[model samples]
Target: METSSLDQVRAAEFASGGATAYLATASCGLLPRRAVEAVTALAERNATGSRGGAGSFDAVDRARAGFARIAGVDPGRVSTGGSVAVHVALVAASLPAGAEVLAPEGEFSSVVSPFAVRGDLRMRYVPLAGLAEAVRPETALVALSAAQSSDGRVADLDAVRAAAAAHGARTLLDASQSAGWLPLDAGAYDYTVTGAFKFLMCPRGTSFLTVTEEAQETLPVLYAGWLSAEDRWNSTYGPVRRLAADARRYDEPVAFLAYHGAEHALALVAEVGVDALYEHATGLAARFREGLGALGHPAVPGTSAIVAVPGLGAREPELADAGVLVSNRAGNLRAAFHVYNTEADVDRALDVLAR
Candidate 1:
């Protein structure tokens, strides 16, 4: 599909939604109407037992390819799953018993917890700004969110990646908060995981992992099953002695419904392009921040798609009552703008907060 301008995108794909100002996309994005229909149509096919109805696998393949385009990786490097923690666990489990894992302080739990939970792994936390400088020869892995979930602070991925490479340490990037509107190359890291339910704007129950070939060979195949076989259809009833040679070896059994919606959602993202998405979303966030300043509720400083105002978390319910739905996290009122949002939406939210 040819990419559309942000104007065409908002009007065509994101025009209908319930909230007066859906400023909570950082919490969970608004699904495009086509995505909703794709999911619903799959369910209808299942219920009616339509001819050749077992086409759910097609959706999975399409979503995988769509995400590959978004992440700038080959489909073979991509693996499918349902949770960030679960995928991260694979990387964590592969670390040597006493390997050191370096991560940013206040990084999202899924990105850090997997390594932490491994009692033998030494987990060190540093501020996001100092992460690159903190990487050492002893650090076996450097893990982080591409964008901080708490305040929308984007990490310097280039610096971190270079530091990790210099130290011969692998890098794992969690793009759950960044992938949709933040253009990034997943292949740049040793491993990258993203949950589609949030910024990727799909339904719950689908996540993706991309691995470098070296990382794939280093990780174990402890979770292999019928679905992990290179010939899944033929190996469904057997011991599945041979797993897929690529990242698909890490695949969990497919989630039919989630990927059905994801196929459409990821395609829409590709159609809109993340660079355009970044401009459109962050523009609204900047507008919202400017308005918040005028209202004397200066937000956490950043140019990302999410704007969080400290000390205004208590006002979340007040804004919601006034039809401006947003989120409160870590004592900050977080508002995220996406393709659907407009200056009008930003103004409406500011007007509500003005009182």
Candidate 2:
């Protein structure tokens, strides 16, 4: 896309409606204008009882395709989930009983909670540095975030996958923090999960779980609802005899309304180009680091969108007071950059922090 047109797109759609500089896109991103219209249209249709379920289904299908494009995989591999945590848990539950789940210590709770709560499995919290050494014969899976939410450190997925594969274990990656904003070879892992609420620029409650052929072979269908059937609308229910022949067999029904907005959000990402978006975001982050460094508040270096400043917790309220939004992660202020972010946003944040 043309640079001028892209800037106009961001200004007209992303920055309208009193949008803030929202440096917290790593957490909860702003919903784009197209997405807002999608949700509104769907709600209106439903309220009038003219809701074409076909439109909702198309939205879901498009959403699946959108995420698949980002993950560099076919749509057949992607499944819908209400949220990342739910799908992560479902995937965890499918593992062999009494198996071991190796995860990084201080990882996001959603990534670890599902495995930790599994009574039949043992969860080992190891450091990111210890992941390779921790893989053992009993290890059933290695769970990790593609980008560390704490400091935005991009995981060495190739190394992690190789280590897990050496022990005949599957690898599950949470791409929630990195997917829409970063260039990821997501198909490298056995399974991957991401949500649309963050950098995808949609509302909450839309998650995509992509399962590789290896994962589908070993992972059991833990849950199968109407949406998981080959003929979902076939209400001729007898004993639930037929299941989908693909990964959809494990999926459950989600809020179709949310997906209408998610589809539009994903379209926006495609228009902007994922690789270009990552470059744009990281460029802004580099500028942020330089500016903050000059102000004696250098942010820690990392490859992903989030820029973490160590020990800046006390400045949270001050930032909010200045209309500059950021988040506190691991006792530091985290300012995230995305395709919608501008240099002015970074300058505003820096000016506020310098106070």
Whole-model lDDT per candidate: 0.88, 0.82
* Candidate 2 lDDT tens digits, 268-348: 888888888888888899999898889998778765678999999679788887777899888989989987788889999
Regions of candidate 2 where Cα sits further than 4 Å from its true position: 17-19, 51-55
lDDT leader: 1
Winner by TM-score: 1
Q: Candidate 1, residues 1-355: lDDT per residue as tens digits?
A: 2235666777777755655778888888888889999888888888899974555777898899999999999999999999999999999989989999999998898888878887999999999999999999999999999888888888899999999999999999999988899997999999999998887899898899999998887888778998899888888885997788888889888788889999999999988778888888888889989999998998888798988898888889998998888998888888888888888889988888887
Question: In model 2, what lDDT does residue 42 have?
Answer: 82
Worst 10 residues of 2 by lDDT: 12-21
TM-score of model 1 vs. true structure? 0.96
Provide the lDDT at 177 for model 2.
Answer: 90
Clashing pairs in 1: none
Clashes of each: 0, 0
